[model samples]
Target: MNQPHQPSRRILLKSAAATTAALAVGTAAAPALAAPGDTATAAAAPGGFPDYRYVKTLLKPSQLTYNPTGEIIFPCIRGTAGRLSAPLGRYYLYYAPHDAPGGICLAYGDHIEGPFTEYPRNPLVANVWQPHYSVSHVSSPHVMWNESAKEMWLYFHGENTTTRLARSKDGITFTYDKVVLSTSMLPAGTTETSYARVFPYELPSKNAHFVMLFMLNNTTNHRDIHWGWSADGRNWTFDQKALVSHNDVSAVNIGGPHLLTRGGSAFVVYNKDKTSGGDLMITEVGADFTLRRHLGRFYESAAGAPDNGRSASPSFGTEGGVPYMVYESGERLQGSISVARG
Candidate 1:
């Protein structure tokens, strides 16, 4: 992800009663920040889970068949092909180059370890949607399949302040939905809201079927993680507070949150910019929107890894039950898609 114009830029709760109350109204005030040198209430947990071992560069900007000039960053994978339209392939790899005119692009392969082909026309979605709206660029593509609607849900952002949604039955042609998230929903000092990922989760309310986690840039110019809840996957409501902050992990900035469930407990796997080679960190969230503990670094690149001593923006997947992570490996704004498995 790029430096937010020099500006800015999830898990279950443990308390059942608190979770129920928060879910009922679709909002929860984040717990107060801990004092300096403290990480909420507990020490950093040791070791990362799924223990990602470096794989290979899945896609590089220079390797793209079309518009291969810029960097390629965020990666989201869906196992099944589109239901209402012809299959693009058995698997769809959604990614985008986080540069000006950052286009939401697509590529496909028969296997997770892809000898993938980019969409011939390229840039499935662009910054300008004509009559709807326009911006300098649009990037950070995260995709999910809506089973009931039989459509693909694409979430992305532009101009930093807004995160928009679009739906496509064919997974190729999309119709603009709405701006599901913006900085206005967050606290007063929030400057930007972007990099959102939506997942199906069991919240306590009957109307809510999904949860969203994203980055929030504050007045201090430090980035933190914030979240929202959704009913029917289209409409959303947010918490006025942050889910995780730079102070929570003693980092200058923190972002890129992906939900990971292990042993029936939910944890958020994210990256923090405290080191030159940014390390992926994990934290446990409770039933009341309370951040429980700061899990320590899981994956930090060695001196010569393809991540080039830098890694950020991770999305997880499994091939035959073997877990893996696809992440931005290279320099921050200028990166390539690299993979790792354990």
Candidate 2:
């Protein structure tokens, strides 16, 4: 494993201060901030989840990945959390670096606020689907630890068209499993099914253990959010319903569905392309994973800056009851990953 070069405390403080100032004035209403001596808990945002304050950047683009030569890679997207290994006392982050020979990668850190060290044997999930799909691209990973199965279950897409599965006892080494869901599982007219979030949770009234929210593309190139359920993490049955359609929201494009559970309620955070740029929106999902209550836009791009291009591809995780988000923002093709707390 190659450890990240740590920066000095003074450098970190100066960078954080600049980022905080930009966030404070970027939006019309500044998010609630934690007090001077309060490094443990973030203040809650009104009409949002409690004790959720927007913290500064966690992993900037320059920190995403590195080549064999130790050169920094850019344009990393959809970094998702698996589980906090109680035994190891570390958190696992699986992300997709949208570069050549693309595949899923892994990073681990002692804390969510991290100088996360990248696993040297990265591309943990390699681009082995080339012969089958004719394209080696593999990205958009969503991973979660399944307690009942005693393994970390990873859900990701290949060539941005189908969803697949992999499992690992330890978060590092993974064995490829079958394709759990794909366009074949969607309705007759659907074109593709990709970019999914899979996790284990009991419904308010049912004992079903697995839930998935994925993207369903149509003939017109419009992408809608759909969901599915599974008795186990491997087998899935599509609900054949659109959770968020293009017409349902202001944005023309809607993708990147991430589920955050807090206080016994489940919230879905997704990305949308607004007229100005892009926005990250949230909605409350019913315990059954059917009913949705839109929570409006949570983060938007800053005007005339690198971020003004767009803000999309969000992943959520919490540490010690404090919530954090890692999402892609900046000029679309040249975008980078940024972290915020709430």
Most TM-score-accurate candidate: 1
Report the C-alpha lDDT of model 1 over 1-342, residue by residue, as the tens digit: 121112210122343454444323211012111223432222222322444566677887887865644678788866553243556676678898777788989888766557678888889888788988889888888887777887789999997889999998877889999999998888898899999998877677546778899999978999889888888888898977778877878888888888765444567778876352377887888543465677777676644547666778888764433345678887676678876654
In order, candidate lDDTs are 0.71, 0.59
Residue 320, model 1: lDDT of 36
- Name the weakest run of 10 consecutive residues (lDDT summed) in model 2: 1-10
Tens-place lDDT per residue, model 2, 290-340, is: 667787765655554335546676665544333455666565545655555
The TM-scores, one per candidate, come to 0.83, 0.75
Model 1 pairs whose backbones collide:
12-286, 13-286, 13-287, 14-286, 14-287
- By lDDT, the best candidate is 1
Candidate 2 overall lDDT versus native: 0.59
